[model samples]
Target: MRIALLTEGVHPYAQRAGGGWCRRLVEGLAEHEFQLHLLAGDGGGSGGGGGAGEGPATYGPATYELAMWGRRPAGRGPAAHRRRAYVRAYRELVRALVLPGERGSFASGLYRLAELTRQDGALPAFLASGHAQRVLEREWRAPGADTAAGQPLVRDVLVAGDLLEQCLRPLSAPWYGPGPGRLGAVDLCHVVGGGPAALPALVAKRLHGVPFVVTEHGLHLREQYRSYRSAPYRWPVRALLLSFFRLLTEETYREAAVLTPGSAYDQQWQQRCGADPARTRVVHEGTEAVGREAAGVEPEQPVLVWAGALEPGRDADLMLHAYARVRAELPGARLLVYGEESAPGYLDHCKAIAERLELGEGVRFAGLPESTAQAWAAGTVVVFTGLTQRSPRLLADAMLSGRAVISTEVGVAREVVGPSGLLVPPRDPAALAGACLALLRDEERRARFGLAGRLRAQERFAVAPVVTAFREIYLELVSHWPAFPAVDGADGGVPRPFARPAEYWVAGAMAEAH
Candidate 1:
């Protein structure tokens, strides 16, 4: 089956994002043909890097590449003929987004915009127009608008308008309609990331009757809330931005044929964001097993290792405080932090915290280790202090390395660690310190937990099972897709035989029984 893999800033291109998992999926499902539909972004802010627009970064020969939407083009503004309809559609879209409980309007307006774009390819200029700002301002002041209670300023309106335009820019892309490298020919539209990345798939399903699938490694809505929480904007601007994202997320969830979350935590978030429980499935991400030789190796100095990207959410300060408490008890104990700095000055901030705590040599920032296996071998116990995570790769590596873990109670850490390691509440230095001390003080328990962890990683977290699960899901979705109106004289442009529904067999069976 041919699948159109949709991603926004995450796969086949971005180095630091969830591209690794996406690359794994593509490589694992080698039997099926993949058409890459990338929603590229400007390489700025956290987790940002080179996108498809920076020229093609190789993802091997099996993938067919399509258009990438990154930087907006400089154009002569919206055409005169399309202005009226564009204004009307744009107004309704902003109204539905700003007002409370207007999903119907939101969906209609979204599709209307998609249709307009599909027909004329003139959405970008219209979205960036002065008329768009006027529509947004009018909608903000509309009666009974909950978000408008804040009485937004002109600056707020302008910023919100620009932000909305960026979010909706995918509609202006030329790849939505019929023909090769477009959404029309794919058997299934599987969106690897959510939010704007899923926009094309939504349009494809609406325009071509194609089945849509969403796999969220991270909760897009939750991440948006975190990102916009401290955004240097007024409450109304933040509200507008967040509300738009929420509406988009809900639409994506409601329309998806299936929702595959990387962890149960992510699944719960999706359900809370209006995903149907029956349609949601938990497909845990898998990793390769590191060598068992690293297990039970006693280092000269008792060391605790924390590895992964140094981000604010990782709560490195909490790690330091806990390590300080540990040092109070065991002065010789050392905490080795190994990972790349995700944000500028975050590493320095962590270092300052360490200095303030007077954990000079007791805490060390080892940066990215040359060999992951060697790094795992250097630690007596692996630690994860991140306040939020969805199937963190470092935790999986730690388990596979056969090291006992002490991770905060967030995301799927408990589920990932199970009985093999100790769990503590997040942001509690005392609790984290206690948990770390428990594993550190007991050699027998550490050895036993290490063995169990290795077994669990091999049994449950291996890459083979994840690949098999997705392969099955792909086949099932394609095989059971309902028949729809043909495009270009082809049956919904899906692979033959499976494009048609199984109603005939069911009817025949019932008739025979009667």
Candidate 2:
């Protein structure tokens, strides 16, 4: 079967983003063909020498076809006709955002803009125009509009417009409508993330009767809410943008053939955001089992390892406080932080906190390790202090390495840890310290927990089973998808033979053979 894997700001080229997961899926299912429809972010720039259809060299050999679509160029300005159409369509879209009852108008306006984009190819210019700003202002100030009370300023409108332009740019891509080497030809469209990444897949399903599946590793709406809450924009601007995201998610959830959340925590978020419970499934991220030798080794010191990017979400400061308490009880205890810095200045801040606490040699930032096994081997206990997480890969690695894990109660951490590891209340350094101390003081208990963790990882989080589940989902979707009618004589009838059950094909083949 051929699959179109849709992604934004990830895959085919990105080194750290969701690229690794996409690469794994494509590589694991070698029997099927994959076409990567990548919607490049601001940093992604234009497509390389591979052009639009061929995979880039960064992704290695030609296992899958790659189509790169980038952000609209800033230089090209829209013409008078296109600008007028953009204004009308954008006005309608904003109205739908403010008034939930106008969802049909929202879909209509969205597609109208898509149509104009196809004809004029100047969506970027339209979004940059003063007319777009006027349209947003009018909608925000409209009577009964939720944002009317906030009274947005000119700067807020401009910033919001810029953000909206980026989000809606996917509609202008050539891959949306019917054509060769586009979404219309794929057997299934599997979106790797939510929000804007799933927009094209939504269009493909609506326009061509294709079945699209959404696999969300993180809840896009929750991430957006967190980001926009702290944004510099005014309340009105934030409200407008958030409303747009909420609407997008609602529509995507309603239309998707299946919603695959990486964990039950993520599944709950999806359902809360209006996803049908019948269409949702929890598919855990796959983790490769560690070698027995690596799992069996004992560390030379009583080391606590925290392995993840140094970001605000990781709450490294809380970890430091907990370690300080642990050191008071166990002076020989060491904390090994093994990961690259994700947020600017976060690593320096963590180091400063450790120094202030006089944890000189007690704490060490080991940066990136040569291997996950090596990192886990350097520590007796694995710790996670993140305030929020969605089936973190690091925790799975720690469990697979047969280490006793001490994690804050967060997204699926408790569920994943089960009885194999200890869970502490998030943001409470005292609780975190107590948990770590408990595991450190009892070597026998630690060994038992480690063994249970190793067994759990092998049984539930192993790569083979997760990959097999996805393969089955793809086959099931393809077999039941509504077939589109043939446009000409060369085109076959609607509900193509591929959509028929395997038994039908096998029976026909047997009769032919006889």
Candidate 3:
């Protein structure tokens, strides 16, 4: 079967953990042909010789690489009739964003704009034009509009217009056409999360009746909300942009054939965003299982390990305070932090906090470890201090390596840890320190929890189960959907199961052998 994998920002090219996961998914399902529809944030420095539709040289071939994104060139404005059509669609779209009662027009307006984009190649340039900004300003300040309260300035209109143009640029992407290599020809469209990345799948479904599935490790709407809260925009601009995102998420969730959230927490977020519970499923993020030889045997000297990107969300401050408490009692306890600082100055901020607490030699920033198993093996107890986590891949890695874990109660942490590890309230040093001390003092309990955690990780979070689940989902979607453009000819005809041979579930195992 041919699958269109839609992604944005990170995937295949990025060296980050998110990119690693996408690479794993594509490589794991080797029997099926994958048409990658990536929307790179910056369409440059890919080390490849050319631009969009060219996969990185390592992958070999344009069919596998249909990535798009770059600075759009300024062009002539739309023709007279086309300008009127643009105004109508842009007005409806902004009305849906600024007027609460007109929210239902969002889908109609969005699709209309997409159709216009397909017809007019200059849609991005048109969106950046004064005509588009005028349409947006008129709607934003119209009677009963939510954003009118802010009395938006001309500068706000320009910035908001620019943002809308960037988000809607996917409407102009070339991936939606019908034929062998387009999204219209795919047996299934698997979108890796949602937001603008979903625009192509949305367009394909609207134009060709294709069904698309969305997988969310964390709800993109939630991420947008968090981001916009700290965004340096005026009330009108922030309100307008956030409304677009929230409404877009609703559209994506409402139209998706299935929503696979990596954690139950994200499933709840989807439901709140208007996703049907009947169509939602919880599929935990998968990871390669750590081998027995690579597993930790429990470190000496009562050392505690912290893994994951060093960012504010990881709450290194809370961990330091908790460790200070642990050090006060145990005196010999040490905390070793492993991972790169994701944001500039975050490492120094953490170190400063440590100094203020006088943690001294008791704490050490060890940078990223050679391997996850090695990191887990370096400490007696693995501590997860993240205030929020969607799937916590490192926690799974630690469990697979057979280490006792103490995690702050957050998204899926309690679910992932289950009965195998300790949980504490987020931001509470007392609870975290107590849990750490308990595990550190008792080797037998630690051993029991470690064994249970390893068993749990093996049963649920292993890569094989995730790959199998998606394989079955793709088969089920294709078998039941008769309108799939790829299956039916120009003349309506009976639908058939995917033409590909039975999936080779051993692809991962074979790759490991090599």
- Give the candidate number with the greatest lDDT: 3
- lDDT value, candidate 2, whole model: 0.77
How many collisions between residues are there in candidate 2? 0
The candidate with the higher lDDT, 1 or 3, is: 3
lDDT (tens digit, per residue) of candidate 2 on 321-439? 99999999999999999889978999999999999999999899999999888888888999999988775577878888888998998888977888899998999999999999999
Winner of 1 and 2 under lDDT: 1
Task: Provide the global lDDT of candidate 1 against the true structure.
Answer: 0.78
- Can you write out model 3's per-residue Cα lDDT over 1-514, one digit (the tens) per residue? 7788777764322211245556677777788877766666645444221234556554332433222434554446678888889889888899999999999999999999888877766678788888988898888878888973688899999888987887787787766665546777777788886888898889988887778999978677777777776677898998898899899999999999999998887888788889999888888788766445536456569999998889899998889999999999999999999999987999999999999999999999999789877888888989998989776566778888788999998988888888999999999999999999999999999999989999987878878788888877887877666544442354245343463323432464688899
Cα lDDT for residue 101, candidate 1: 61
Residue 423, model 1: lDDT of: 88
Q: Write the per-residue lDDT of candidate 1 for residues 92-128, one digit (tens) a residue.
A: 8988877786656998899899998777777877877
Worst 10 residues of 1 by lDDT: 45-54
| Candidate 3 lowest-lDDT run of ten | 10-19
| Candidates' RMSD to native | 4.7, 4.3, 6.8
Would you estimate the TM-scores of all the predictions?
Answer: 0.86, 0.84, 0.87
Estimate the lDDT of model 3: 0.79
lDDT of 3 at 299: 58
Model 1 steric clash pairs: none
